[model samples]
Target: MSSFLGRGWSFPPRFDPRTKEAVMVADETDIAESLHILFSTNPGERVMLPNYGCDLRRMVFEEANEQTVTEIKELMRKAILFYEPRIVLNRIEAQLVDPLNGKLEIALDYTVRGTNSRHNLVYPFYLHQATHPVRA
Candidate 1:
């Protein structure tokens, strides 16, 4: 029983030396395609990503913030160009909090992204959708 549990298949001696030559590296096009395949415009558990050198920090938007529709759209545009997120949803949330536990108030929620590891077989794709509004 012990032998059977430990026994496993072995590669041929001639092919023993596994080289990195066979590994196919991903390029810009490959990454974009992978993103498309992973994220859908409409779905569940949409992902949030960190791009533009931004870290994965908690986001909280204050209602008093002077953010306009145009600004939000512009930010979305830039994000689309840079990270190529699937799309931005029509809904947005607003709140005020100290994410870093500092005295500053932030105006934003979370944004999703696709991959973390460069060598990951599947790149992560982000999807942004406005969450459903709750009734009082």
Candidate 2:
């Protein structure tokens, strides 16, 4: 977690394969619910709120510790590029595990959607050393 705490974050190129100018985040309802919870927990960080189209602006969130600022900003840029979503919901969930070692972890989930879609797409990711996070 220390490694993740200080590094800049980025996703590889070719994140989306769709050609319609928009891509739904995912088809999972539970993921949507989780994203809702994450958003509700942090409202100020939501730089781009959803609307009716794909021409949405990117958003960035500054972490409390300021250590993951680069990672959070990168998250915003990637969300904009991959989904071109109407909104960018940025959130950080943190918990303390070992006080002696100062081991903590943060989770970031972005809810992005395509135009003319019925459901929202939830792309969730968490950071940890040696384990890849899941996103769609």
Candidate 3:
């Protein structure tokens, strides 16, 4: 049942030394990782999927207030509605962790569609981003 959730390469790309194959994640773990990727990306990050993300990068300059929380939740809702067809979202919550540090904890509660399994992923968001990124 969970097979419908699908599997993908792990973020940052790990590999097994013996097989020399990329590490993959599946089931609820895959979903959680996908959520992280979706939130981490900006709309134009992917050239093919121009409208694919929640635009968290743009929120870096936003004040960590109620409106910001509302906006973040809405963005998550829209991203999930458009990209993720495997889960039914239960609720989204953004808790201000530290305004001075510009951080928020975003919790996403959802149920897997084919398996009827409930799961939650808590993602820590930081509004403070480094200016002038150094290309490595």
Candidate 4:
């Protein structure tokens, strides 16, 4: 039953040094990695599955205020609900890290369906000006 939590290519798609094959991730790591991809990708970014990802980019130009935070939370919920079925999402907290620059941190609380293992994942969402480089 828990095997339904699948195995997939590692995020950033690295290769094994010895075998020169693509690295893979399994179980909870795979799920977490997939979530990272989901949050990073924009909906319609994929040609084959046009709606496969989260649409956080839709609000790229929106102010990182409460309303934008709420909408982003909904986007996360929708993406997880539609694309990932291995876990049940319990709560999502989208907090503004820096509103002026459009940075947000989304915290997710979820449980795996088969074994009831609890997990927490924090996904960082940001826009182009979200951070400032320090100059000494």
Candidate 5:
């Protein structure tokens, strides 16, 4: 029986060159991978899927504050709701790790659709200035 029998099909299906077998991902691991991809990809980076990806990167360039945190949460909500059909968001929180350095931490709580399983994930991102001064 294929390893993918009970587990759902893996996204971005990979294959082992040596064994010539498809790599299978299931459950939490697969969801985590999907979330990572969702967070890492910048919007408009995907050719045909222009609306895909999160705006978290853009938020890094902005000043980190209460408003920024709220914006981040909202962006997360919108992006997740629109992109991931397999999970439903339960809560999202964002806090400034260092306002001066434009570092922020985000926490997301979600439940997999069709199942009662719940999961939480935290992500850290740094937004640096577009231009930096050169010290002599």
Candidate 6:
């Protein structure tokens, strides 16, 4: 457990006034946080690391349909396989929350490589254009 503890530090550390130290998160929480960071980041957005993110954003502007869903799933599968070596992907589900609103919902089921512990994560992304008009 102590060996795993080193890898369980939370992404956004929480302060503990009594100990004057950051609170550590459980192992599952740490893995979840790492996945969130990986999915949220866009390729080329990271400094000097241009190929670091998933390609889901590229299909966001396209119509939400079967083709879009398939593409998104492939992108997710590739990204996770390439970037996250600690987890083995079990399944990926993607769909539009509302075609009119252009919101997409994605769920990923994975197992931690060495431990074989299963975990699932769902993420919502907005793909619609701004409703309000912008003044020049």
Task: Find the candidate with the highest lDDT and give its number.
Answer: 3
Candidate 3 stretches greater than 4 Å from native: 131-136
lDDT of each: 0.29, 0.36, 0.83, 0.82, 0.73, 0.73
Runs of candidate 1 with Cα error greater than 4 angstroms are 1-64, 67-77, 99-136
Model 6: per-residue Cα lDDT over 1-136, one tens digit each: 5246226556655678999888777566766777776776689898987898886556656776788778778877888888888789999897787778877778999998768888898877656443211111
Per-residue lDDT of candidate 1, residues 1-136 (tens digit): 1221122222111223476233232333344333332222222234553234221111123222345323433443344455544222333332323324322221222232332222212212111212211111
lDDT at 33 for candidate 5? Answer: 67
Per-residue lDDT tens digits for candidate 3, residues 28-115, read 8888888778877789889999999988677778877899889888998999999989899998888987888887888989999978
TM-score of each: 0.21, 0.26, 0.90, 0.87, 0.74, 0.76
Which residue segments of model 6 deviate by more than 4 Å? 2-26, 129-136
Q: Against the true structure, candidate 4 has what lDDT?
A: 0.82
Per-residue lDDT of 1-136 in model 4, one digit per residue for the tens? 4567899999878899999999998889889888888877777889999989987666776776788888889988999999889889999998887867667778999998777999999877775553322211
Off by over 4 Å in 5: 1-23, 129-136
In model 4, where is the ten-residue run with the lowest total lDDT? 127-136
lDDT-best of 3 and 4: 3
**Clash number for candidate 2:** 0
Deviation of model 3 at 111, angstroms: 0.4
Candidate ordering by lDDT (highest first): 3, 4, 5, 6, 2, 1
Identify the superior model by lDDT, candidate 3 or candidate 5: 3
Q: Please give the lDDT score at residue 109 for candidate 6.
A: 94
